[model samples]
Target: MRLRLLLCVLCWLGTTPALAAENSRVLTTIKPLQQIAAAVMKDIDTPALLMEPGASPHSYALRPSDRRALAEAERIYWIGPELELFLQDLLERQDSAVDLLHLPQMAVRKQQQAHNFQKDEHASHAHGHEHDHGSLDAHIWLSPDNAKVVARYMAEDLASVYPQHVDQLQANLAVFERSLTALDDRLQVRLSPLRDKPYFVFHDGYGYFEDHYGVKPQGIFSLSHEVQPGARHVNQLRQQLQAAGPSCVFTEPQFTPRLVNSLTQGLPVTVGVLDPLGSAIDVGPKGYEHMLEDMSGALADCLEAL
Candidate 1:
């Protein structure tokens, strides 16, 4: 009887760490997804980011470390094939991974094609699963409403994996929703004044944000960050800029091509930087909010009257 009791105690001790490890291994594909996951898993487990800052998801290849991270993770959250193309095959092998874009609750927007730029000549050579780029804009996190849906979905998945922390996850989701609501109200007021102001973005990625906030973008220079606009397209953009006299032209930190300088060489438009991936922002519970606030500030700074 004594021997049997001792073996039971030893087995219980050995299983504790394994159980803890199972519950704590949450991973996200990008920083923004990490930010949302971190917010939902606050005080539970800090979700790890797969793609480091400054890396473009459109063309990123998976490192060995990323493969290991995916294997070890008990729960994985990502924007799906349209965004993180590198993860498609690895995720197919893992049935547990959650594709946030496929969630019925998520309000997905269609990808906006570049107004005058030609179709990608290398579209066939593009890596990852064949994504319908025209069908959906996988940058769903840009919209606060979509972020809320993602947070709720994350909370549900986290609760299932770590049942002991369900209460905390639900609580975190509530707080995130409230914070998002407050931020939306603030941004609406701040960005409303710039509704009529015209601007140009380097790429069509900002459609969701622009549509959500009613900000005006005269046009986009490229359909995808990986693709460059042709010389004729650039000349057309120059002519449009000359005629419309846009308040600003926004370029992303990930791609500050020389073309932007060429477009505004003698124009009155102010240049501003926008970071859609939250690449520079530190990942935490409030990272998503900070990203939206920063974007709003960038827009207002350039769009407001001098």
Candidate 2:
């Protein structure tokens, strides 16, 4: 079931949001989302990025300056409370913000990754992410299909708000669709071989990508990023890793704690980097594709070496 947005971002293209269209500044919560909004608002005005690249939404804290960004922008977009816990209260105090997670067309992933290795086990201890039970996974922007839905939503809403820029926004959406199609095809072929390759992640934030590309990890080190796994649990994970032999362990760029290095030490595993937020990629019309391509490349490069 789709949870309602506190301010009903569901009606972003409605009359209320369209009240002020002239020079309305748009803001997006993260880099991936900023990239998509940029694509739709291409050449009109670039949407400001709220969370910088390489920052984990799970741990981000909203600042007074960020509040100024929120107040200044006419439209703000973000994944809902499940992911960006810090932004929930702030959004409740305002109406200009829209929760992309609440979009009706969104393809929400209720549970974590659908991995065969985790069916019988309680990976809840050391899984990728431990969202509240039955809560939606807020990484909705990772899937290309979902990306299309977002791009269209942005176009439709922006067109309604700024009727003068309708043609340009529609054209931009057309180009974005074409580019996403090509990216999706290439990813299908690129990640095809590595789907069955056993792997693990420091965070289970990659469910959308994994499910979309058919790449499932063996298991994860910890489910809650905020909690430290006990020595007993760590040893059990190490034993499981030793049994698997030469697989890869992917770590996110934002949080590469010393615990990760200690967990994989002396094991027959290659520790690789996977930046979910695409910290190094430039935010632009093609930024989303570059980010995903880099992620796929990182996975393929690390897994193939083993």
lDDT of each: 0.78, 0.77
Kindly state the number of residue pairs that clash in model 1: 0
For model 2, how does the per-residue alpha-carbon lDDT over 1-306 read when each residue is reduced to its tens digit?
A: 355673466676443322332224888888898888888888898787777666677677766657677888888888888878788888967788888888999888875543323322334533334556556878887888898999999998877657899999999999999988998898899789877788988646787888999998888555334455566666777888899999998877644467676678999999888887788988888888888888889998998777
C-alpha displacement of 157 in model 1, angstroms? 0.9
Error of 2 at 108 (Å): 0.9
**Model 1, residue 6: C-alpha shift (Å):** 48
Clashes of each: 0, 2
Question: What value of lDDT does candidate 2 attain over all alpha carbons?
Answer: 0.77
Candidate 1 lDDT for residue 223: 30
Those runs of model 1 whose alpha carbons end farther than 4 Å from true positions after fitting are 1-24, 116-133, 223-230
